[model samples]
Target: MLHTNARPSDRHRPRGARGFGLAESLVALSLLALLLASGLRGGTALRDRWATAGARDALVALVHEARSRAVERGGAVVVLDASTHVARLESGGDSVRQLRLASEFGVQLDLGARDEVRLVFDAAGVGRMASRSLHLTRGASSARLVVSTYGRVR
Candidate 1:
């Protein structure tokens, strides 16, 4: 008979069974936190960019809708009221449509020298105003909707 100095429990245990130590777990947790922080910052920036794009598209759509309504109704005027942060359509002294801008989008409109900017469209779907630029800004991003003298939106 051979004699060995091993306990009965040790004899039944797997040789290479190991688990993560406290220090290793702490390091992993720290790395995870760092990654989460970076991801959160990136997400915030992406959200802002998305909001800016949405606001710009909304502005373009408003202009196009106003022009279409003018053509359909024989003539129309689109009013961008800064005080209300809304775009309103009027045709033949009757209200057509109103689009309210979301405050979270941070859209700033530069309509030159008017508190309420008006873009007039004739029955021919041509802009009746002189060549003008409408600036739309959100945070650091900006887009310009140019209304040419020929009544074209570029």
Candidate 2:
């Protein structure tokens, strides 16, 4: 069978012997490098996301504890120490509960203007502070925890 549409170069070597050209090889290597770089970036982002989420959960639990204690002890204070990553609940000038966020989540806090944040809850379990914003960071990721005046967390 004579092929009329075949290329002039097709008359040379046997079939099934073709290999990747230089351009194909370079493109493959480039794609592999891109995938590796993205994977590393994704891993760092995942780590930071997990840490920030853990910190947020800890904050909500601490806030709830403070509110509950205030209902029982007249009033309670939740003092967050950014430097040490410790949160303390105080009632009647005595510590009721204390937790270290960094010990578990390895997160850092950024509270504007001060290294501490104090949110007070009254006997009715209502928050005494205005809407407060706290920033939690771990490595390259960050998250916000907004505490409403009614002690609601988001």
Candidate 3:
């Protein structure tokens, strides 16, 4: 039985929720697009940051490798910054090189001095009679790879 004041049409109202109107649908679509755009932009930025950091870490690791190789081979291993994106290791100033690597991440290397030839790590894992400064850079960020006067790497 229906209430005395209830309209007959109201009795026939369908159960459950109603569907969205055109205006509501449009507003929802707009909100979704905005969210998607923000997410994609953030993702791209994070990827670039990761790539840059990865490149920096890899270069540091290469320095360690060069030193270790020099000690293992009982000779001077020269680490050269062939370019902003390339590096190589030459043993005993010979044309024959042991290892070479190119940047796979979003970073670059800039030598502090043009006159600087190459990093020579002796058989004891110590830099040659000199210290060198290798600059690790990315776009606007930079880190100094300093070799101490005592042939210590820092």
Candidate 4:
């Protein structure tokens, strides 16, 4: 009374048994897409922040450079901005250098109520403008870069 043939379950299993169900596949795909989208958005935000910060630091450096140059060369140095975003330094009608910041950085210098901004530093490293506030803005946030008289550059 021994049975020679095996039962149907023992003979074979479905080849696609290891594969995920349709619902499971759909959910996994959706999660992956969401993750990818968020990562891309975060990267974009980070890039914008980095560009804005770099531009701000460059502006600060330009101010310090102009002051230092005036003291070192024993002459008057000028930090002027012909446009809102572009800034340069000059000494005795000669352009000392052009800053690396351009309009693409999203940095705007708002003079507030002033007609123009022409910061001049004397040979003794003293600011001639007395007291002034230069606005540095990126997107919705802004900060003031103030310079006081007595050759002080802040």
Candidate 5:
């Protein structure tokens, strides 16, 4: 007898429910925040991977350039300045290329028990330092670059 003006569907009100309440909204919001946090973590991991890979690739390319320059110019030298974190390419007593490892790629280079490591390539593209191991690191990723005596990279 107390029937108000309510829609037919609203009259039934399945399970006697009105609509979403504050509790339901809070639950949905919490779920969304959890998913967002997980996604951000994945993105951070991906960024670290890219940074590490970029540093490693730059070192490899530097080595290749030094080798080719030696063959073309009869001799080339790469000086790794641990203090400055720079890789300098010298040809004819001039700095042909300089790579700022830390500033450019946010990578750290470890030179074992030395402040400098010099790599010289002869006219025949032969490397003087053999079995020299270099470590490139960024964030949680790391890679080892080794130059063999036979001008081969391992």
Candidate 6:
């Protein structure tokens, strides 16, 4: 058997530096909690932005579809009604599509001077109305879909 000069109490002692004190541990925990909270807030803002973008894209696509359909079918394609939260498309008195916006997105439509805007596209892909701007808004952010008299969307 090997002989050792160390005392019995020395065996129970830590080999090197001691672990963190109570105050140090508390400070670390508080920092971690603050970091987590900020991350959560960022995530929520990102989600809201995504939803707003999605809603705007969908609206633009609907307009394009109606325009194309009017040219192909050789008749009028109409966006029958558009309000703060909904838009309806119709071709030849038949429902083409309907889009309902979510409340969380807070989307609003601003078709100037019109309670409900009827967007009419003729067979030649020309709009009956003059050049106008259709505004889509979510909170402070907004997107504009401009409709020219020549039936161009930008």
Best by lDDT: 2
Model 4 ranges off by over 4 Å: 1-29, 36-49, 100-104
Rate residue 18 of model 4 by lDDT. Answer: 57
Best-performing candidate as measured by TM-score: 5
TM-score of each: 0.71, 0.69, 0.62, 0.67, 0.75, 0.68
By descending lDDT, how would the candidates be arranged?
Answer: 2, 5, 1, 6, 4, 3
77-142: candidate 2 lDDT, tens digit per residue: 999898988888899899988877778788888887789888999999999898889898888888
| Reference-based lDDT, each prediction | 0.76, 0.88, 0.63, 0.70, 0.83, 0.73
Model 3 earns a TM-score of 0.62
Report the lDDT of model 3 for residue 48: 60
lDDT of 4 by residue, 1-154 (tens): 8765755765575655556889999999999999999998777767666766776677678778888888887755545453546677887778887664446576666777764677888888787776777766666556566677654545
Per-residue alpha-carbon lDDT of candidate 3 for residues 64-100, written as tens digits (9 for 90 to 100): 7777777878755555554635656666556444333
Better-scoring candidate (lDDT), 3 or 6: 6
Q: Write the per-residue lDDT of candidate 5 for residues 1-154, one digit (tens) a residue.
A: 7877888777777756777899999999999999999999888777767776787788788888989999999988889887887888997788999989889878788887888988889998889885677777777877788878755666
lDDT of 3: 0.63
Instruction: List the candidates ranked by TM-score, beginning with the highest.
Output: 5, 1, 2, 6, 4, 3
Segments of candidate 2 deviating more than 4 angstroms: 1-41
lDDT accuracy of residue 92 in candidate 6: 74
Cα displacement (angstroms), candidate 2, residue 53, comes to 0.4
The positional error of residue 130 in candidate 1, measured at the CA in angstroms, is: 1.9
Per-residue error for 134 in candidate 2, Å, reads 0.4
Which structure is stronger by TM-score: 3 or 4?
4
- The reply for model 1, stretches above 4 Å from the true place, is 1-25
On lDDT, the stronger of 4 and 5 is 5
Model 2 misses residue 79 by how many Å? 0.2
